[model samples]
Target: MTARAFPCALGAVLLTLALAGPGRAQTAGPSPTPDHMPKPGMSAPEMADRAAGRFPQPVRVGDLPGRFLLQPEESQPVLGRVTGLVRRDDGGADAIVRLDGVLGLTRLGLQPLAWSGVGARLVAVPVEAVALLGEYVALMGMTPERLRALPTFAPGSATAIPPGETLRIGIVRPFH
Candidate 1:
């Protein structure tokens, strides 16, 4: 076709699409398999209510190894302040803690399987194995002195300590 005719056809096509948008009612997508999706506002089955006495035993805390301390790298909210800290409470090996929730870093916390030698394997870090980067905490350095100092469990332990003054933060397993 000539250039004039081409332009006219293009304009027609554009007008058709514009008009179709208002005239058509978009259909819903195919329903997913019953087991594959839940109805709106529904909740998935939770672990059985141990307190309800459905079984003999209550949900044991130790059964949930996931409840143990999480490294800053393990949690993604992008910001964590030390919530509760106590050195030598769980013995001389580690500190007990309750890490304050991080900000804007929750999605990052979901990457537990991506943290290792293959697919993010589990890597346990000592309570002292981290530092605060303004709002971002990181595993940067660790020394006995630094551990007992910043990112430490002393008086000000839970207070989102700052990054290294001199110590090079490094990971530490429970044992030496």
Candidate 2:
């Protein structure tokens, strides 16, 4: 088409689209379903929740028989600080923890796992664990504040804990 005609044609198309408005321009299409997609009514979040809850009973970290803790050369001892601890009615406690530094690991080690971060998690610990927080709380070389200074009942606003980072007790059973 001629240059003059081309401009006119483009203008007409733009005008048509503008007049059509967003609603009439395009109708919502059915979401694409992947071959390995979860079953209907079972969303990804729900599936994850179900998988996490599969292991109801909590196991001790030291009880795991095997060489699982075998350190790959890349793995560094990440420091974990206990920011808050709340005692549960069932004798277990909810702990708000903050992980320090990024510890690089192989794909088989830390891939698809968000373990290193500020997280508020439920843990299986005795009520007395609060009193002995210092022994349980380990932060490498840095000297943490007094045990009483840390929030022991609920997460304080100053902590600014992240959401969806709650690690279940069954997975990496809490220490203390």
Candidate 3:
């Protein structure tokens, strides 16, 4: 597959993840894992606070392992929420996300995010919202069955899907 295939593949996966589920209830909080401690800078209690969504920086991709997928034009620093998830039979899962902010290639230029939600299909960020670079996005290629997953809210929140056994699809760009 070519480098551009990444986005197309991820688009299908996002659709799958967005629509997956047996209509389960959204879990309220995260479960604790004693063995998994916070990153070096954070104290134990500080980690706990981060898990509870009390930290100053809510979305820290630095905390996640492995290289995440993003467009070449996309900036290194990004902020977003993993909104949807679906467990695959093979042990892997799919996920949908929303990037709240990002810096475009040129300092003066700003790009908008394209999002496909349950109600809103694939739509680009409105001109008004483009200044914020807020875009609803989707991502895959991570095991959601593991204890500390990439898109989980806390250690073990009800909505949190654990890391799966494998990545069915390699990381690629979204299908435009």
Q: What TM-score would every model get versus the actual structure? A: 0.21, 0.21, 0.20
State which candidate, 1 or 2, has the greater lDDT.
Answer: 2
Q: Rate the local accuracy (lDDT) of all candidates.
A: 0.31, 0.34, 0.31
lDDT of 3 at 117: 18
Model 3, position 114: C-alpha lDDT score: 38
TM-score of model 2 vs. true structure: 0.21
Per-residue lDDT over 1-176 for candidate 2, one digit per residue giving the tens place of the 0 to 100 score: 99889999999999999998877555599755432222344433444454344343433323221211211112323333444444455534444443332443332244433453223222222212212111242221111222223343333423332432333332222331
Worst 10 residues of 1 by lDDT: 43-52
| lDDT of model 3, residue 55 | 18
Each model's Cα RMSD: 18.5, 17.1, 23.5
For model 1, the superposed segments whose C-alpha errors exceed 4 Å read: 22-75, 78-97, 101-176
In candidate 1, position 58 carries an lDDT of 22
Which ten contiguous residues of candidate 3 have the minimum total lDDT?
Answer: 123-132
- Model 3 lDDT vs. the true structure? 0.31
Better of 2 and 3 by TM-score: 2
lDDT of 3 by residue, 13-61 (tens): 9999888956657666885432222233343344334333311222232
In model 2, the runs with Cα more than 4 Å from the true position are: 22-49, 52-122, 125-176
Tell me, by lDDT, which candidate is best: 2
